[model samples]
Target: MAFEYAPAPESRSIVDIKPSYGLFIDGEFVDGHGSAFKSINPATEETLAEIAEADAADVDKAVKAARRAFRTWSRMPGKERSKYLYRIARIIQERSRELAVLESIDNGKPIKESRDVDVPIVAAHFFYYAGWADKLEYAGLGANPQPLGVAGQVIPWNFPLLMLAWKVAPALACGNTVVLKPAETTPLTALLFAEICQQADLPAGVVNIVTGAGDTGQAVVSHPDVDKVAFTGSTGVGKAIARAIAGSDKKATLELGGKAANIVFDDAAIDQAVEGIVGGIFFNQGHVCCAGSRLLVQESVADEVMAKLKRRMGTLRVGDPLDKNTDIGAINSAEQLARIRALAEIGEDEGAERWAPPCELPSAGFWFPPTVFTGVSQAHRIARDEVFGPVLSVLTFRTPSEAIEKANNTPYGLSAGVWTEKGSRILHMANELRAGVVWANTFNKFDPASPFGGYKESGYGREGGRQGLSAYLKAGA
Candidate 1:
């Protein structure tokens, strides 16, 4: 008999979400001129709050505010700036539980992920960048590196506050004032961050937020005064942003989508490999750009890996995002759920054998069971395309060379994983993988001090560490 867990939902009372939210510009919540959109709880499909949409006019106001703040913020001593960052980081830690709960409610991610992975990393990003504010001269970009005038940032909903941290912390550390836009579906944490900025006594206009959808993002991307743009989302939008700034002088960095291959060699530790594979595809309901959606197993061990994978997947609990025992949560939105379903159908039609763990889904919310498709070939749509959901495609390879070839065949070069006990082969594979970030024997791990990004269509420019700092700085004053 399967074990059952009693429902352990995190209390939502800690976060006092306002009934309606407005755009945060120049350290104030200003009413937006555009129509309001409702933010829903993906777990229950209930409206959580009405969020003000920022149209082009509001985008203009935010950019101007950031540009104005840049003059003063960039002139402040790095030590002073560092203090503000430290304060922001402290505030995030102080209210970590509240932010985690809000994030889970807004993004449909499991509360465990929001509490453990997202919030902690969000605070670490600020803390990591805080130390760099005064020591950037040693960052190999020459002495007295100057700040870009203003940075315009846009983040995705998968890890809302974390992505905001990935963009905002580094920009501020480099002395660049910012105008950040959170994903339309998940804007609460970013707004709450504006409150954190206030608590830190961060100067007005130094960090502005304009909440909205694509149009608002386009306005920020196309704004003439935004010195740099940092975006994390779909490849289609990343390309559009690149085209919009083709002839202009605005610097940009994009951390986009991926179809990463999790290669499992015959000699890998089978149990650990199983755990890694499950974590790679099922974590955060698989709403991850670098999700190991394609599982490549060496032919010698393919059957063993598949059997173990299936059993492990079957044990995953799926349901409420707030449930402490839930392994997989609701899909972020209805549209995203539909996209995942369509792609999964294509996988089935293409002759791949599809299997999902027997799991009951919440009737009202957007949900997809943890699924795996076997007999997936390189040409299979499910293998080639990023499902961006808790769906895994299993493909078999005969040799290490074949694994590398299959892994690099895709247009995405964001991230990849290798599972093997042979140290030499692991190093060899690491050197050959074209991904910007490669993991050996593990998957989906991230750190604030480590630089992360991708090559090719997975998007460009780094988002952390000393390299991340350079994205917002000039060579010399």
Candidate 2:
């Protein structure tokens, strides 16, 4: 007999989402010049709130606000700046339960994930950067490293609050004011964060949020005054941003897409490898940029690993994002769901064998079953491209050299994983994998103290730790 879990939904009462929201500029919520767009809960397709869309003019206003604030904010004593970050971090902790619920409702991730991973990391990022604000002289950026003026930041919907924290914390710690634009689908938490700034008594215009679609982001990036641009999203857009700022002086940092490889050697711990593979590819509905979507198992162990992986995949619970017991929630949007479907279809049409666990999806929401494709080759689209969903492609390697060759075949170089008991092999593989981050016997782990970024078409520039601080600071002359 199969065991069943009781429905345990988190209460939405803690969060009081408003009917409508506007641009957060100069520390105040103000009207946008453009039309409003509705933000919906991806799980149920229910309208959550109407978000004010920022126009080019609105973007200019936000830039001006950040520019004006930068004059006073950049010159403030380092100790004083650190206090505001500490206060923001504390306020986020005090309201974490509320933020987590809102994140689940707005972004369609599991309550467990929003509560455990996203919210905690968001607060920790702020806290970590807070201490750095007072110690930049010791940060090895030379004596009295100067701020880079205004930073234009754009974050994605996958890990909304955490991405916001990642961008905002380091920038502010380095004395740069910002005009940030949250993705259109999930703008609520960012608006709420603006309120947190007000509550922290942060000076007006120190952090500005201009909510909108791509055009608003273009405005911020192309603005003559923005000294720095930091974006986390697709590789195609990262290229566009790079092109837009080609002849300009704006410094840019991009965290883009990946097709990471997870290699399992014959002598590895099979059970632990299965768990790592699942967590790597299925976590966040596989919307992760560095998800281990490509599974490279040793030919000798492929059969055993596949059997165990299929068995484990069957046990995942897929349903309401609010349900504490839910493992996979909804796809972030109808558009993203369509993309996943299209790619899965291509996987089948290209002669790859597709498989999904026996799981019933909720009737109303945008859903895609956790899927895997076997008999995949490096030339196949499913193996080479980023599905950006809960889809994994399995391939076999005869030797370590073959594994390394197949893994680096992709144009992306974001992250990869290796599972084995051999310490020497592990160190050698870690050095050989052409990814910014490598996980040995583990995957998808992140910390605010560690720097994270990518290489080649995956984009460039670090986003955490001391290196992240340099993105907002000028090198000593």
Candidate 3:
């Protein structure tokens, strides 16, 4: 008999989402010049709130506001800025539960993840960067690294608030004012963050939240007075941003897409490697840029790993995002769900053996079951392309050299995993892997103190730790 779990849904009442939200500019909420758009709850396909869209004019106003605030913010003592950052961190902790619930409702990630992982890390990032706000001289950039002027930032929807924390915390810590555009589908948490900025008594215009789609993002990126640009999204857009600022003086840091490999050796702990593989590809419904979507296993142990992996996947609970027992939740949007479905079909068309555990999906809401494709080859589209969903492609390698060659064949170099008990092998693989971050016995782990970025199509520039601060600072200052 299968084990049954009682539903323990988290309460959403704590998050007092407004009926409509406006652009957050210069410490105020005001109407936008562009048309309004509705923010939907992916889990239930309900309209959560109407959001104001920032047009070119609105983005310019925000950029001008940030530019004006840069004069005072950049000139203020670093220690004073530290106080405000600390206050924001404290407030985030105080209201973490509300933020987590709101994140689940809007973003369709599990409540447990939003509660335990996302919100806590968001606060930790602020705390970590707060310490550096007063100590830039020791960052090894130079004697007195100076702030880049106003920064224009855009974040993706997959990990909405967390991505915002990654961009906003260090930029503020380094004394630059910002105009940030949150993804249109998941804008509530960022708007709430705007309120937190006000609650912390941060200076007017220091951090502005502009809500919109692609055109607004382009406006923010191409704005003349914006001195810096930071974006986390698709590699195609990252290229566009690079092109937009190619001849300009604007500094850019882009964290984009990936097709990471998770390699399991015959000597590895089978149970541990299976769990790592599941988490690597299924976490956040595989929306992560550095998700380990490709599985390369030694032929000697591939059968054991696949059998255990299929068993583990059979037990995954996919349903309401608010349910504490849910292991997986709804996909973020209809468009993303379509993309995942299309890719899964392509995997079948390419002669890959597809398998999904017997699971009943909700009648409503966007969702895809945890899926795996076997007998996939390096030449297959499923193996080469990023499905960006809860789909894993399995391939076998007979030797370590073959594994290394297969992993490095991808254009993306964001992250990869090596599973084995041998320390020397781990070290050797870490060195040989072309990924920006290589994990041993673990995957999808992140810390505010560790630097994270990628290479090639995955984009460039680090986002955490001391190196991250440099992205917002003028060189040789």
Candidate 4:
């Protein structure tokens, strides 16, 4: 049965682009003289808002505001400071329905995911960190940890509001002010978050939301006054951020891209593995940074597992993101959809068999069929590049060593999944895998308290858990 959801009160899946957008600086929205750009809805290729393109000048303003607020907000008692976060979380819950609709409309994630996963998790993140405000001394790092001051956060479009919570909540808990920039492709939720801040009556200049393309992100990252730069995006951008932060006094944390391997041994539960594989890559149209895009199956059970995966994939419901029963949503953007198609073609040209479940995709929207490629080699472009769409590449391995080798072949080490009935194997593989978060018999698991990040090219630093709070802590405090 398909689930039904009340759409945004406006009921238009796509929001109209305002003539111009204001930069949320110093706790108030201000118009910027810098360039402006249009953010569009991927589901229908319609404009949602005309966002301000912050150049070096605009970033200076937002950073300055954050710096001003940090002097006061950072010194307030932790318990008293937490009240603002509590208010934000409450406002998020109150406006979750609107946020869910906005998220789905802008980012092309299923409404179910935006509602049940993104919205709730975002609220929980604020709520979780709100308690941590006064308890920093018990966070295992030490007593009286001070704020890092003026953090510059750059988030991706995959999970807009959720990523915002992951970045902002802990920063506040640890007493840092933040200047954040959402991806150019998806900025609605962040703008709405600014509204929530207004509703919370959070002090001005404590949290600033800037909207623009890559240059805007660069402005924030390369700014001199920024105490820390936290970014979640592709490995290419992650590398750029690392280099930019290097030789500078700024502290940096990156939650970059991943090409995680979902290893399924022959002894693993085939039924469970089938669902895991589908949910791994197909969830959120496979826009996840830690999405298990690689399926590393033991050769002994490859055929059976592959067959079952195909059968299961056939039953997936792909359609309107606002529809409750949609198992897959549209690709995040037109450029991303084109990239997926190009990569799937590359897989076919490289001699992999390409298959997609028999399904009709939306005609007028950015869409890509859930794709699978078999006979994948380690050297294939499809295997190497980060295809941020609903594409899966399959390969076979005969031994545990080979499984580990294939799983670690990519430069990404954000996450990996192991499926087996053997507890010993799970422990061994978890220890051996270089990924940050290892999933046993599961994939795509997330928590506000679970520290998540990547190793190697997948990027550095942790996003959740006690360790996450430390990112905002001042050094030598």
Off by over 4 Å in 1: none
TM-score of each: 0.99, 0.99, 0.99, 0.96
- After superposing candidate 4 on the true structure, give the runs of residues whose Cα lies further than 4 Å from its correct spot: 1-20, 475-477
Backbone clash count for every predicted candidate, in the order shown? 0, 0, 0, 2
The Cα error of candidate 1 at residue 81, in Å, is 0.3
lDDT of 4 at 410: 83
For model 2, the superposed segments whose C-alpha errors exceed 4 Å read none
Looking at model 1, residue 424 earns an lDDT score of 97
User: Which is the better candidate, 1 or 2, if ranked by lDDT?
Assistant: 2
Q: What lDDT is obtained when candidate 3 is compared to the true structure?
A: 0.95
- TM-score: the better of candidates 1 and 4: 1
Of 1 and 3, the candidate ranking higher by lDDT: 3
Candidate 2: C-alpha lDDT? 0.95
lDDT by residue (54-119, candidate 1, tens digit) is 999899999889988989999999999999999999999999999999999999998999999999
